[model samples]
Target chain A: MLAFIIRRLLQSMIVMFFVAMVAFLMFNYVGDPVHQMVGIDTSFKDREVLRESLGLNDPVPLQFVRFITNAAKFEFGISYQHKRSVTGLFKERLPATLELSFVAAFLSLVVGVPMGVYAGIKPDGWLSKIFMTFSLVGVSLPTFLIGILLIYIFAVTLGWLPSYGRGDVVNWGWWSTGITTWSGLKALIMPAITLGLFQLTLIMRLVRSEMLEVLRTDYIKFARARGLSDRAIYFGHALKNTLVPVITITGLQIGSIIAFAIITETVFQWPGMGLLFLQAIHNVDIPIMAAYLMLVAFFFVVINLIVDILYYVVDPRLRLDLGKANGA
Target chain B: MNKPLLSVENLRIEFPTRRGTLVAVDDISFTIDPGEILGVVGESGAGKSLTGQSIIGLLEPPGRIASGSIKLNDRRLDNLPYAQMKKIRGKEIGMIFQDPLTSLNPLYTIGRQLTETIQTHTDMTGKQAKKHAISLLEEVGIPAAAKRIDHYPYQFSGGMRQRVVIALALCVNPKLIIADEPTTALDVSIQAQIITLLKKLCADHGTAVILITHDMGVIAETADRVAVMYAGRLVEIGKVRQVVKEATHPYTKGLMSAIPSLTHRMEELTQIDGTMPRLSDIPKGCSFHPRCPECMDVCKEKQPELIDIGPTQVACWSYHDRQI
Candidate 1:
């Protein structure tokens, strides 16, 4: 297990390295750096000095090595536009994004799993048809539109909730939470719902289809023959079998959820990494953008590793079998 | 007189299709007295499994009982609501499926499955259920019952898994067990052991069994009474000895002769001339007429009903004229 983790970390490091290199190359080649770094007001001589200092004079290969080494230590130079440590900027914003994503993921699971199970058990039932239709809308409708609609209903019409921004968050020292206060929770609801709605359907559909497949298996028929109650047959026998695949899809989906939260964060003006990245993009803050790219890619690798480990925990067959394959 | 543990009267199973309804089991009827092992023997698609499924109330959808009444201890089971029938399933009639490979849920421990079945039907507490489950595992011959109880279904071999399924069926101590080809997927050696175990369990508990199999040898060894089926109808019903030694119906005789035996050193194995007719294309008369060596014009013109013929009930025009 330790070897497996170590191997995953090594692979992730290689992937992150490539991601960092790509980000560095992509940003460097997009228009002149002088306007982005020092603004158009800077003198021609100043731009020359900036170019030299920034290693534009060095070979592309040498420049990539420097960027990689600095990135390895979480130092992505500095946000030239803001005159702030890019790492510090990322740190300040990460907690908010983490809090948002976690809540959204939690909400998605809580709603999706049970509903999906119900729909799967009765695919032709009216309730399931309704769920499928609703799920279709959730799948097809864009995230930004959902976000706007949520605001229009709750904030503008119903006037029951706040439309935007993280409201009065309490810093619990280790983790700041918008959920800690009422208004903060209220502020969180719209954006979190907007972010989670699509994932809810994705998970629902995944779980529903997986549950359907599992339901059709021979073991399920035997389970039914065992005189298990509809509830036990479903939740105990079939649903437990369905969980392994559902969790895998959920793990793969976490990346997309985080990706969608970028738009959601912009819509709600939730002061998180997405909002920070947006500002960085407008100013062409190459350091911040590069840092964001490497970090997000790293998150994907780490999350995948966690999901792999989770597969072991959920299934004993995999534990005993994968032990031999992984030699750990 | 003691009531038959299970009784099915004119049990006709049908499957609705785009082409119209297909009759799978056509007006088949049988009874299982308490502690009796009624061996149902037939070729593939002879509806042996379908009859068992109908009894167990687990027939696949699109297929349902069209005209029949299944009574367990005089309680009508044919048209009981699904929820009520589900309640009756593990409690009243245990079921063992064909392939033990996929019978037990791989996710759960064998012990948990056994205990869950026990709890589902009986009023056993968790600890008592666990104890009983371990005992069941031991009874089924799983070594180190206590330790093996916590093991998943995959850990056990195929024979061992079938044994576990038997134990699982025995958990609630139902009056009847519908074991559809329980030994079909087993090795020849292991098959003997399982049959022996089943026979012993029935003798001990007075649990009636409807053992559905294509193997005549299994029926001869394990079954007290044998019902030979052809094209969804019972062609003969008699004592195992009578049916195996001297079958009256042409289909039963053909079935008996087809079994390869060490005593017979024949150059070519005896085989029935033709296949069982498809449900849609069942001939006007007896389904076995096309395949029977004794096929007559009367056999091809009218279906035969089970008629008394000495030690056996034979459904053939050839025997219909014979007095007991």
Candidate 2:
């Protein structure tokens, strides 16, 4: 298990390195960093000094090497707009995004899995059909649209739920956030639902189809023949078998949830890394943008690593041989 | 014989299709007394497996028991509620599917499966159930039964998995077992061992068995009585020895002739022409008439009902009145 984890971590690093490289190059193409660093009023000599200090005078490749080396130490330089370390900006907003994602993941799993299992068990039942149709809608509708629709309903039409912002007088700390407050939790519901609905569809559809396929398997039939009750058959035998794939898909779906949470956070005016990213984009904060991109990449690899570990935990067959996971 | 362990009568299984209902297993009837082994032999698509599946209420949808009744211990099982039938399944009638690899869930240990079945059907405590599970594993010939009980299905060889499956079926001490080609997935040598082990287990427990397979050799060695199926119908059923020697049904004779014989040194094996018709295209009256070498004009027009012919019962026009 240790060997497998080490191998995966090494692979993740290689992938993250390429992502970091791409993110570093993106700023060089979009606009000159020199323009943001030194205004027109600054003398040409002073501008050249600034450019040289920022390593803009050096070759693009040399600058990239320097940026990569610094990024390796979690130092993506200082954000030009905020005048704070890129890493500090990320650390502050990372918790909010994590908090939002946790709620969204919670909502998605709580509502989606049971519904998926229901649809799979009763493919023709009215409730399953309704859930399936909604699942399709969840998949088809964009996150922004869902966010807007939700705000229109709860905040505008009904005037029941809060529409935007994390919370009043929010404490935006690295560990503690608006999420820690009651009003913040209430504000979280709308965006979490909006962000999670799309993922809910993915998880639901995955679980439903997998459940249907598993329901038809010989083992399930044997389980039934062995006189296991409907509860035991459906939940214990069938559900247990369906979990490995569900966990893998759900892990991959986490990337999208975080991806969608950016839009969701922006729509609700919630304070998170995604909102920070958008603001960074407007200000042409290359350090923050590059860090954001690398962070997202890092998330994908880490979550996938967790997924692989979970697959081992859930499926004994995968744990048998160290490198034969694919062959198996 | 007073109340046979299992009695299936005029059992017709069908699958709904867009065109119409397709009959998978036509009107077939048989009974098994306690401790008796009844081998059901047929070619592919002959409904042998379907018959076994129907008895255990494990028939895949949209295939269902369309007509007739299945009685276990004098209780009607054909039309029981799904919940009631579930209770009867592992307790009254156990089933072993054809593929052992697929029959056992890969995620669970063989011991867990056995104990789960035991606990579900009986009130045995976890400790007692675990002990019973190990005993069952040991009984099925798994080496290091106590230690190996914790191992998953993938750890065992194909033959060992099938043995584990057999042990699982026997865990609840079911009155009857429907073994659907239990040894078909094993090596030829291992097939004999499994068959012997199964026969001994069933005899020791006095559990009736319906061994469904296409292997006539398995039937000759294991089955007390043999039932020959063609298309969806049981064309012949009789004492194993009598059916082997004097198969009155033409299809049964065809099956017997196809078996290789070391004593005769035949230049070539006999071939029964024409394939078993698909469910959608089964011929009117007798399904085997197209393939039977002794096809008669009436055989194609009218389906023959199973009738007694010496020690065997055959469903063929040739034996209607000893006309042959």
By DockQ, the best candidate is 2
The chain B TM-scores of all candidates, as shown, are: 0.97, 0.97
Write down the worst ten-residue block by lDDT for model 2 chain B.
B315-324
TM-scores for all predictions: 0.93, 0.94
Off by over 4 Å in 2: A26-30, A52-69, A169-173, A323-328, B322-324
Model 1, A53-76: lDDT tens digits are 878899888888888888878898
lDDT of 2 by residue, B208-246 (tens): 999999899999999999999888999999999999998
DockQ numbers for every candidate? 0.74, 0.82
Badly placed stretches (over 4 Å) of model 1 are A26-35, A39-66, A326-328
Clashing residue pair totals per candidate (backbone < 3 A) = 0, 0
Per candidate, native contacts kept equal: 0.72, 0.90
